[model samples]
Target: MVSEIHLSDDLGDSNLTVSDFANTLDAAIRTLLEEQSTGLIAGGKISNKLVELEIPEKLVVIGDIHGDLRALHNILKKIKIDKFVLNHNNKIIFLGDYVDRGLGSIEVLYTICSLKIQHPHSVVLMRGNHEAPVEFPISSHDLPKRMTERFGRRIGTEIYQTKIMDLFHLLYLITIIKGELFLVHGGVPTDLSNITMKFNEIVPNETGLFGDMLEEILWNDPRILPDGKDWENSRRGLGKHFSSNVSKNWLSISKTKVIVRGHEPCNGFKLDHDGMVLTLFSCNEAYPKFSVGYISTSGIRLHSIRNGFDLSEMVKIL
Candidate 1:
């Protein structure tokens, strides 16, 4: 029979204190990291600790970075991106899941945090479902176990530092740009009221499973838009495509303005239904795979998204 949630009660000497966890977990992670070259893992562990950067022009948005630092860095160097959005307010909203499934999550967070510091007012960093503890359930193959299996205690402890925990606390952070555009990591929750509230109210841990209304807000996939205006849920994976129906619904709930988001990967940067919404995935499969995406809301003629990430017909954007 399969093991039944073998999570340990100890979590080693982490930077941030988790409520409950076993101790051996840190030892395992340290062993793994050492066996696999602790030096490199140590470098990656600190990648997401950046400080400052240039301001964005108008706005720039990125998608699931998935720890691909090479790809992320390449895109940053090539994009000549502006970090601030002045008139219509240009900013970069990382759709979510900045870490895992790849490498370099540390760097991705550092750059994002760096941008946050540089363009404090213009930088609108939001959270993805991956930020939720649920994403790292004891059953995960790469996390907890693989992470523990590699990366040793020192590196693992950093993963739970004040920086990461703080980010998780506000994982559901959002911004209703111009009171029209609702900028978020995933799709707006099925419960429209949740979106109407502040960012922390929808944070999973902070509010727990109470009347907080986060399961859907932080977890709902946009692909499950109502079919034929039926308002039904689709079986798309958590990485569901944002349906035109969802766009329509979000528009109505937020007053028929454009809804820009990042969750599922498109060819690269794409604009649908006459610029009503846009998606700019920053990471690309090529270039150490850093080809990232962004949006430019300048000139105010129509919303335009920019990116170094490309589409090779591998993704399905239902």
Candidate 2:
């Protein structure tokens, strides 16, 4: 019922547009990431350095993190997980967009994956649209390599290739929590009903396709502008692809009234459509793009996950 909420569904007889759906999906990624980032910071889980597996007091969700190992490190450090886990337990939810744009995505994901393995039960990893073969190569299809070529040398390539590559296959585009919060890398598609992202557990060669049963977790986002306000993301393909198209279409489908995402950059966490949707970019001051987000049952929060600025509390419910 919660995941069934979408704006497109309300329009019933109307057609869904890819442009709108893309924008909406992008925004959704940011929203969920914002939820995960600080949630990890406010970790109230019960894991020990030597022990494994424990219950969680809260869920820490992270937003889109391009290959910025530095920003990723900062986010992990900034999370006040210990503070939250004092009485309540907690878990970490990574909402996808883990690769591309920045140089260190390969390492970033591996680091997170390492954490997931170390803290197994406490970590949740979702897949983003960029996790495909087109994203990992050292050539043109790979933005991580391109960014690295412009920046400097990365610490480890083989480690990322071997260790992190395995996790990529196991990630999901969307991850729903307690059946209350819908977490996806992209926005939902119209007619998305009873769809689920099984990324909480990582396995080899598992995947979801695009269509009525679209990869909502990896495909959804919030609308870029207010109702009747047009927005264009040149960075994306002429505002027709998921960057703009699909988002609008999906927004109209869900019944939740509002969607969240992590693909775009915002001066800070933002709300549009009279609060119908929320957008939060998790990395700040990242090489090319940066944004971070934090979300919880109470509300959503935003923060800057970059090096220039010390990791600070971007968003907090309490």
lDDT winner: 1
- Model 1 lDDT at residue 29: 30
TM-score of each predicted structure versus truth? 0.58, 0.53
Runs of candidate 1 with Cα error greater than 4 angstroms are 1-57, 79-90, 134-151, 161-163, 191-213, 224-246, 270-277, 286-292, 302-318
For residues 1-318, write the lDDT of model 2, one tens digit per residue: 012212221222323232332233333444334433333322331111001112235556667776755555555655644343233245666766777766555445445644543344456666666764333232312643643343334523432344344445545444433212444555544332332332212112223333223333444344554444343333343111223333434434322233455655664356544443455566653633324455532222222221112122324321
Per-residue lDDT of 37 in model 1: 35
Encode model 1's per-residue lDDT on 121-176: one tens digit a residue. Answer: 44444566666654333321134333344456665555554335545544334445
Q: Candidate 1: global Cα-lDDT?
A: 0.44
TM-score of 1: 0.58
Which window of ten consecutive residues has the lowest lDDT sum in model 1? 42-51
